[model samples]
Target: MAVIATLADVRDTDPVDLTPLQSTVDPEELDSLVRVRNGANGDTHVTFTHEGHAITVHSYGMVAITPEHELTAEKYERGEGR
Candidate 1:
């Protein structure tokens, strides 16, 4: 089977717990986002800023979180986010 890694997994952060982001984003909305994008077509994602961090959650079961400013620089350097 295929293995999907999340933002926490990539960043080596805490486990997959959206409790902290609950205050910033509605849990139900987040759940809906994930549910709707679970298995669709092309790259589908939602971006939001939470606690000064830019967060992008993808459809295939992964989230990318990075500092607002640094995110641009990093993505540029890596030729990502094109």
Candidate 2:
């Protein structure tokens, strides 16, 4: 829900316009994994791309979404885009 809402907000479009997060990643598994990591006070993080955006969902309740261009820039900045 959060991921969809965020991606939609960032893209300035309705949630229905975006691909469902379930197609990219298993929500229930992700939640369970993050929940356990959070319970243990660990720094759990997961990153994936959806709808041309790079998304990082942190166990601490932070969701960072980077658009395709920014992601390309970041990868090139680190000399990995090529």
Alpha-carbon lDDT, every model: 0.61, 0.85
Q: For residues 1-82, what per-residue lDDT tens digits would candidate 1 score against the true structure?
A: 0011344454455544433666677756776666544344656777887655677776676677776879778888998977
In model 2, what lDDT does residue 25 have? 99
Clashes of each: 0, 0
**lDDT of candidate 2 over 1-82, digit per residue (tens):** 8889988999899999888899999999778756535466877988989999989888888889998888789889999977
Tell me the lDDT of model 1 at 49.
Answer: 79
Q: Which parts of model 2 have CA positions greater than 4 angstroms off?
A: 36-40
Index of the highest-TM-score prediction: 2
- Candidate 1 minimal-lDDT segment of 10 residues: 1-10
Candidate number achieving the greatest lDDT relative to the actual structure: 2
Pick out the ten consecutive residues of candidate 2 with the lowest summed lDDT: 32-41
